[model samples]
Target: MKNLERFLSEHQQLTRRHFMRLGAAGAAALGLWPLTADAAPAAPELSKAIETLEPYFTPREKFRDVSRGKPLPHSLPDEKKRAVGLTRETWKLEVISDPDNPATLRSPLTQKDGTALDFDGLMKLAEKHAVRFPKVMTCLNIGCPLGMGIWEGVPLREVIWLTQPRENLRRVFYHGYHNDDPQQMFRSSLPISRVLEDPFDLPPVILCYKLNGQWLDSERGGPVRVVVPEAYGFKSIKWLTQVVLTNLYHANDTYAEGNNDIDSWLKTFAATISVPREVKPGEPMPVTGYAQVGLAGLSKVQVWIQSNAVERPTGDPHFTTAPWTDAEILAPPKHWGALPDGKIPANTLGFDDATGQPRTWPMRLAKVHWAALLPGLPAGEYTLRCRTIDEKGNAQPMPRPFQKSGNAAIESVDLTVKS
Candidate 1:
């Protein structure tokens, strides 16, 4: 309870619009009638509601092919392309001694002291203690492809435990099978603590063998790959072949060397407003889109329509002009997606106690679907904008001056209210 209070205080940006939704959810959980906004539920009621809504706050375990309905790309660098004879059946993961330390001998997994385990041996170990979870991977670059998949494999920590790393180890560095050329190699390292210290709230780091219930394909960093849910895609090394525990931190991230900020926090409140490019005056403008955040979770999505420019106060250079008129808050769909046989839908709305009408949308989800109706606008040019606020009250980034590594700004669309 104290933790919940602290969390709420720290993230006071949860708008009043979501309070009724949460309150009603809590009432429904207790088998009592849903409360109304005018009734003003107490803090305990809201807290209970939050507890009932906890499952949706985390990443989904079931995989949803959010590849935007396209096939995976096969664009590995020429040097890293697979050889004709190489396949998952033929690939082997190398557990080698720390290359950074000259005194260390090769092969950490062998009892013989200098030999490494082959693919079959590693698989046997992984099979004994496999874990699976769904994670969303996004690239650090602004427009890089995004993907979500259910990853199945052994936790990297378990693998490290098998090797029995020395107490003084400070880092664990790993890389995939790039060409023998050192300069062309793509490698990254994590602090030894990050790999070994499992946090209760975050997903475990894994060496994935299967994605979306299928053997990982080479194009998606297959045979073996790292899945680091907390960081950007660059941290999830692909085509993984080696794991080396070291006492030094390596700065080999290709994107981090130049313009990108590798340490940037994953953007949590980005949203895209989907609307028609043109609409006739006096006609209903149907709006729908999706919102996503990091582990912090989403709170609410606010929409606005403005015709005149206004001044901004957030101090973000991108948000130089402001004035916005509020639009109706949309409702969340009853279910995340079509449920399979024997599965039940997860309700996302709370019913009104008196009339039994739904009062609000479920906002505490990683991905939320939202829709709104705009009625009867005079013929003119207008910008329809939408922004998401995280559970911690942080606003989505404002688009204008490009940020190489920052939260994506509120999404907006220009429309001609035709006569």
Candidate 2:
């Protein structure tokens, strides 16, 4: 079973690398709920929640439904997709001429905030450069973790470069669509160097136009959206009517406005993965789950396995004959984006903040899902847990001491078996 664990771990990292290579297209394929589906109209619960929180901090804007594109997947039949038709004509693309020029770009309808941009200006920017198609866009749906599309337009780096920022400009920010409401625009940010890098060389970031190869539906924020790599889905803002560049190093000021300070680099939370409870010892177990690098990339995933079992309904516990084994750390491949064929990139060696070794404290891997298996357990229940480290050597909080808004908590699953 240890061998099986090794195999599972290898494949999991591979899948994550595959995910990076696909970028926004991969996100589109991840899942896209049909816009026309007869979902119940908006509920009051959301507004009430937003209102209750208003007293403590700056008001936040409510996000609108902007996913109007078909999901990009290989399985769907051509007939199932809607025709792009003339709707495509209404949409246009844009690029920021100078990443640091930062005159400001926001929707024309926005009040004169000295930073709003109109569609015409956006198009003018795009005409100057070639915009890529099918970038991934997702939302951190509080109700349900789901993603969809709105054609995105912008070369992320161009906007970064436009700012003509100083070398210390280590962070990039993003804000979503909003009305007059304070929280109207969902805001987030990522490491500046990652996005500012050359996408063709590493393809760090890209914008999207069509979802599933069709024009985005208006309700789903047809005109434009954004896709970012090596990050959680939330950072990929939609209804991208605005692109702002600044030298300030800050998390989501919008989040700060909301009273809870959210770090731009979405922190990796602590989580767990258990060996499937249904499987018997010696049999191959299905190990699957997702992990994120916050605003960076995953570095390593470490698993701890013990033959001990906790007593059932009764309060008994006992260690198994197969004593706990040494911890296993599954290291991920160096690069997430596609690499030159035949060239194997080494994990960008790093050191744990606490230690100087290549490995960081609380282990970091570029991808997650490196497997862990307990072979030949005496037909008893066991536990499998994981901790993740990012390229920066930041580890997911095990019992995450504090309940930070963006903290990624470790997760675990139970294993039950009968021999």
Candidate 3:
């Protein structure tokens, strides 16, 4: 009787649909439900068809964890506080100039003058100036992107001007919390122009905190990270701690020491997904993969297939003259599972505020997946390769042979059409 009374109290709050969903649980709680069978008949299908969509945002845990430190702070159980200062309540930020010159400013930025920004202060500033944008982060050396994300933060320009910095400062660099060892201190920089003003429609360099609508965790380079959309992932330092204005004229990126092109903007390229090795003749073979839209923008994804019997006339390693055909770039998802509530955030940069659609079809500085269908073939082995064409009319590895700037190579898959 008591169980019935308690259930009756809670059941009134549940919708008719949820009332059915919870009745079994209520029976279980009262020791009256079956051990295996469902409480009622299954409901009818909600939709006649389901659309396959590529994920828009990488889950925080699913994102590649490329954090660098002798022993990563998030990996150390008790020492996270001392190492990276975890948590939103305790976060702090500072934008300062070289100690010698003391920066040109409207508000004198002496720590004594209460100019250091706290987490609350940063949030207050974001009320008006916060911006969000989607970007796919690709490392210069790595052939694939680390991940794609909807990043939200105030532009670095907003933070710097609070200190009233000037063009006299040639560069601005920042680094995240790291192990105290000076040798492990990783830092990256951008030209003062890159941070202070927008040019060529580049996404403004931002000090970002939220990822996929959640407070960034320590493992993902939060309380804040600097996001430079036009540059490779190297330019976006993680676990941000300080912003320093400097007079040095040359790029001082730490990645430069590892013999990398410090300014290697991500290049347009494509790589294959799962392609079958053997298939019966007369069946439509689907080839699918993703393309990275670089600063040059992407016109289309191109694919070329040839049987193994065809001997290539030696000397064209980059395949400059391969007979290629266009593939279909997957359309915008009817539903965005990775986005919050399946709605594109209107505040996203470069997207229409009214409709929340991108101004350009395939957004630049991002990644788009594509697919092609191949007609059936008789018993034979063949190879299929895919590459992207940029808006400037250049194919993969065309304008750049990919020496050290960024990895620019065509990806291929082998398939066998059995009899």
Candidate 4:
């Protein structure tokens, strides 16, 4: 509890690059949930899903297929896209509850008189804190860059404290404003035990009012919103309005309704990037791209050297260490056809570039690494394979685990490594 309080106070403003810097110094630290108040730190445990899949721990050989996903729905522009403006007051803020009674805590963020919380006050509150690195922002699109920018706001824990909950509180829920009917609005939940449970907790889950250090336009969760450190972007809940606490499990939010589809455990899946599919060996090779897991943080990442010269798998191979040197070589002019669609439904993996076909398996991974291997004597053919492991032991699976939403799960990449 002491460590968690300190972490929340310090990291409420940590930036993505800084987090990466921390990773560079050492493998990322995993967030361990305490089973009981007296449990020792070394006692290892598995999440519900991990325990269920304990039978399928067969690690295998795989390759990295870079040109996997075509694009994302957000990339299509017409899907969930909406134009947001600088208008601030049009939005309303809400403060639900602390850690126990979500239903009874439901209420709008407002003044003592019950009027909605004003945008100006929210902005002022955001600026009062000392944020370290800017919050990283990434659109749901696969082809886009992982955006990094400063976010300003109060620690979400602070707000929760202000609302106050009963003594036996344990978890909390957050709901964001949605254009869909109130019943269909986007919402997610977090474990208060975890929120206030660590010492590294910095930049408390902020009630973000600014993005890139500027007031957010309505398009983004504007006027006000929630930013959590341990959950995925969806769980961050934009245009946030209410927060509730409950003792029982509630899986009825947007993603939860789909059995928590792409987001069940919050683990970032592994992927390989080879859109252009051709790279010259030698010279300064640029291996650029991003990888993400849900709430389970990233621990180690790996990229293999491959020559673009053959048909390959949809995803990248499992990567456990950096600077992969023993990667397989590829033959030149490899004519890989469209990614093979498998058990997981098509048009479900990732959207097709030409056609909006739901993607499958490896094709769902959006980002890839690019490399210009050391200058070579001859240029026959080559390919690259890549994969990642999160703080937890989970790796991106081959055929993504069966789920309603197509979000990738922990699995290894299977690219065709060539040279």
| Candidate with the larger TM-score of 1 and 3 | 3
lDDT of 3 at 138: 78
CA lDDT scores, all candidates in order: 0.54, 0.39, 0.71, 0.40
TM-scores of the candidates are 0.68, 0.46, 0.83, 0.51
lDDT of 2 at 307: 35
Off by over 4 Å in 3: 1-53, 82-84, 99-114
* Per-residue lDDT of model 4, residues 108-177, tens digit only: 3544546445566565554654332233333332322243334556666656655545454556677754
The prediction achieving the highest lDDT against the true structure is 3
Residue 224, model 2: Cα distance from true site in angstroms: 1.0
Q: Which digits, one per residue and each the tens of the lDDT, describe model 2 over residues 1-419?
A: 66544544454454333322222221222121112333332223222221221110011122234332234211224332222211233322232322553334332122243433344445556677524321222233231123322223556665445435444354556654443255345676665666766532333455544343344444444445566643335555555545444455556544456445343334453243333567665553434334543444555555444333432243422222212222222233222122223122222223233432234322221223223333334466656655665557655553232443444544556666676
Which model, 3 or 4, shows the larger TM-score? 3
When 1 and 4 are scored with TM-score, the better candidate is: 1
**Local distance difference test, candidate 3:** 0.71
Q: Please, what are the lDDT tens digits per residue for candidate 1 over residues 245-349?
A: 775655545666767776664565544445766777766555555565565666766665644232236665434244322222233323222223211212212
